[model samples]
Target chain A: MRLSELSKRSGVSTATIKYYLREGLLPPGERITATQADYDEEHLRRLRLVRALVQVGRVPVATAREVLAAVEDESSDQLSRLGTAVGALPHGPTTTGDDAATERAGRTAEEVQRRLGWRIVPGNPAHRMLISSLATLIRLGYPCEVDHLLPYGRAAAGIAEHELALIGEFEAPTTQLEAAVALTVLYEPVLLALRRLAQAEEAGRRFGANRGAGADPAADAEGEG
Target chain B: MRLSELSKRSGVSTATIKYYLREGLLPPGERITATQADYDEEHLRRLRLVRALVQVGRVPVATAREVLAAVEDESSDQLSRLGTAVGALPHGPTTTGDDAATERAGRTAEEVQRRLGWRIVPGNPAHRMLISSLATLIRLGYPCEVDHLLPYGRAAAGIAEHELALIGEFEAPTTQLEAAVALTVLYEPVLLALRRLAQAEEAGRRFGANRGAGADPAADAEGEG
Candidate 1:
């Protein structure tokens, strides 16, 4: 396959593919002639993965390279590789302010972990991210009590279990890691879109015509269809 | 209160508050004297919401203005206002390509909605967003069958119901709408962070030292604490 075919098959632009190659995010294809190179199926696969990481996941090219390196580093154990790759991936708001709120959020996160019976992974970035979000909530006068978050934790655990099982079915460690990155990044929109849709539906059920105080008569005609 | 007090209390800077006021995301304070104006608690509350929208939500100033307008539009009925506000709030990826896959995704979204027994609000942005996400999945060769998403929908609905109930506890419609916007934007990071944390924990359970292949002996020392 040539660069053009790689671009066509992977749905990435040829210019972007060349950019990746130049940036060393993609390895150089075999030089066929002065102006042409031959790329293999592995190149196609790698190109697709790179596209997913940079384009779909919105990962910085540098971070994507690091994650890709972790994915391809067969010398590292799978769990460590997974850890390194996910840690490199960005998550949540990075806001840092109000030391008291940060401390409170940290304690609350630990409590949630204890309640959920999960071991702390020392420096997992998600821990910091969780604290950042919780701290913002605390600063804004929102209740971020452990009890308020327990149900969300349970839901997250369930979803993660399902997703991990899916990843496990991929067999090879590299494929599993790639699937982990792809699924983790991509399925977020699926989950969030569903939540928004559900919010509207629940709102409609409560506040739409058949229901609550501000019910509109027009909405009654538009029942669940 | 004045701008400085509003900024001091809300933790937003005076320059940013002035920017919001200039952008009409926040209403102008009552003119009191040369270069000074008086602000009330309502100004404080609205400023907080504006900060949440622009800062935390990353909503553009223009979109924030529209959402704030919808929140303040008492002339509209509550449910309609809810619809407008949420509809205006950007939801998901806006990628448009591969018409066949997009049509397939649209059909799948409809099936999911019908399966969940929810009425399809015409032109609900989330419906399009759900389809866009599904279409992306399809183009990327991922299975987005309704069955695969039902669990997520259930989880989202459960979370949304809990959140809406909390919002409903606010007596005034304006307060409820403001809470809706705040919670919808702010808690996304909370849910996403929880999911990432759960992924780490679940991965640990499956692949950590106590468990599967490639497990690290060192991890065993760091048991649930």
Candidate 2:
């Protein structure tokens, strides 16, 4: 296979493939001549993975290279590899400059973990994200309480168990790690959309058609098939 | 208050505020002279909303403008305004030109909705996202089934109901729309982080130390906090 075939198979453009080659996100294909190179099936597979990481997962090229390196390093296990890939994910928000907010969020996150018996580390990005959200909620006067956080934790745990089990099938540690990262990042929209859709349905059931004061007829109409 | 005061109050820089004003993402303060303007509390509130939309929610400038336009439209009710804001959210992976995957995913999303009795439109971005994710799962040789989606839907619904109830506190339509949009966009990271963290915890409990052959000792140590 040539670079063109690799592009076709991976659904990545040849120019992007060359860019990846230059960035070292993809390995150099075997040089067939001065202007041509031969890509193997492994190259195709690697290109596909790189595309998923950079395009679909929105990982930085540098982070993608690090993650791929972790993936290919047979010395690391599945869980560590997942950590590498997750670390490579683009972060949302953090409490970098706001010390008060950071401290407040940190305390709340710690309490949430204590209550749920979840043993995540102190400075994990997820921990920071959860903290920052809570701090923002409080600042906005919403002040999310234990009652609010608990349901999300329980619900998230249930969904997580199911998703993890699905990816647990890949026998290869690298494949399992890659699938876990890909599925987690890519399917977020699915999870959130379903949740929002469910909320609309539940709202309709509870409030549509004058069933409640806040219900709008237009919402009901739009919600229908 | 002037733009400088608004910047101080909102924690957004003056340059960014000027940019937003130039971009029409923010309404101009009342004109007092050729070079000066007077801002009020209303301006402050609107600026906060815009900041939440752009900085926290990651909504594109154009989409944020439309959502704000909907907010200020005055004709739509709160629930309808919520619909507008939600509709403007950035989408996930879509099935453009991939008819086979779209068809396959459409069937699965329909089944998921029908089973759950959801009232979402067929071409909703979330529906497409669900389809795209499922198609990717199938392509990766780790096919997902109704069994997986059902649990996620159930859990997501539970979280959504609570979240909607929180946003439901705002009595004004525009404020309600803004809060709804803000919560939906900003807290996604919160939700996903919590989910991934929960997954890591659950994985530890189920497979970290001794229950499976692939269990890594370091994973066990990491799991134990």
Candidate 3:
């Protein structure tokens, strides 16, 4: 197949595919002539991954390039490759200012990780993400205690386990990496939407027609009385 | 209290507070004189919510303003207020192109909602979010079936129940709304980070030193056989 067919099959525009080639996101196809190059199934697969990263994941081309390099770095073990790829993806907001809040956030993140008995890579952006959000929650008067978050961590771990099982169905490391990256980015909204829908449903179940009976007895007893 | 006290109590800058007042995201304090006005604890609470929306949630001030209006509209029942506020928040990517893919994504989202028995509001942005993300996954060759997502939905519902329980602990509707909005925004990064950390941990557990024994027995059997 040529670039045209690759573009057609991948449903990516020829020009955008060329741009990917120029950006080294898609490795150059085998040169067949002065004006033509032949692409293969690998190119199509890589193109789809690149499109998913750059377009669907909304990662910058630079970040996508870096993630791809991590994916293709065959020297690294599969576990390390998956970690590197996920770590390279853009993180949520970085924490800033208020050293005390930052410190509190760090301690809480450590506590959750510790409670979960998981060893996270040093300086994974998720650490910063957890810190940033937790810090905000603390500042805003919400209970930022680890007790509130541990259940969430456990649930997240279960979901992640399920997702990783899906990724492991792929035989090749590159395919696994692509699946990991795409699913990680894509399933995010699915998870979030489900959470929101569930919130609405749960809110309805608890508070819909019975405002007087809204609060759980335990929670009601613990309210600001 | 005065503007400075409100600023100090909320940990928001006076300039930002003034900006919020100007933007009407925060109501103006009662005018005591030309250059002096009295503020109250309600002002402080509103300021905190505004800060959470604009800074932590990263919603545009305009969107925050709309959300705040929904929160303050006491004429609406608490459930409607919560629904309105969550719905007003900016959603994930709006899906584009490939009408067939869009239709498939919509059907899939509807199926998941139906399976979960969630009656999602007819145009909730989460619906679009699910569609956008599911469409992307389908385009990328992943199994976008509802079965693959029902577990996620169930898990999400559980988390949402826990969260709403926390919100329910608040006695006042306004306070509950503030907690709901802030928790919804702030806990997002926390949830995402947990999932990523969990993915890393689960990956290590399953694949650390045993490549041949990587997949779960069930998933292994289902691999591209």
Per-residue accuracy of model 1 over B1-225 as CA lDDT, tens digit each: 988888888888899888888999888999999899999988988887887788788898899999998989999888888888878887867665657889999888887877776667648888888888888777666557787777788788788888888888888889898888888888898899889888988887777754556665346435454
Residue-wise C-alpha lDDT for candidate 2, range B93-201, written one tens digit per residue: 6654465655676778887877775775765666666777667655433446776789988898788788778767877756666676777766677788788788777
Candidate 2's TM-score: 0.80
- The stretch of ten residues in a row with the least summed lDDT in candidate 1 chain A is A216-225
**Which residue ranges in model 1 land beyond 4 Å of their true spot?**
A30-38, A209-225, B31-36, B209-225
Native-to-model Cα distance after best TM-score fit, residue A51 in candidate 1, in Å = 1.0
Q: Which stretches of candidate 3 lie over 4 Å from their true place?
A: A96-98, A210-225, B96-98, B210-225
- Candidate 1, after superposition: displacement of residue A147 in Å? 1.8
For each candidate in the order shown, give its overall lDDT on alpha carbons: 0.82, 0.72, 0.82
What is model 2's DockQ versus the real complex?
Answer: 0.37
The model with the greater DockQ, 1 or 2, is: 1
Candidate 2 chain B, run of 10 with poorest lDDT = B216-225
Cα deviation of A129, candidate 1, in Å: 1.1
Instruction: Please write out the lDDT profile of model 3 over residues A1-225, one tens digit for every residue.
Output: 988899878889999999999999999989999999999988988888888888867899999999999999999888888888989997878755667888888888887887777774558787778888888887876789988998899889889888888888888878988888888887888898888888887788776867535554334223221
Clashing pairs in 2: none
Of the true interface contacts, each candidate retains a share of 0.60, 0.54, 0.69
**TM-scores of chain B, in order:** 0.89, 0.85, 0.88
Worst 10 residues of 3 chain A by lDDT: A216-225
DockQ of each: 0.46, 0.37, 0.40
| Pairs with backbone N, CA or C atoms under 3 Å apart (clashes), candidate 3 | none
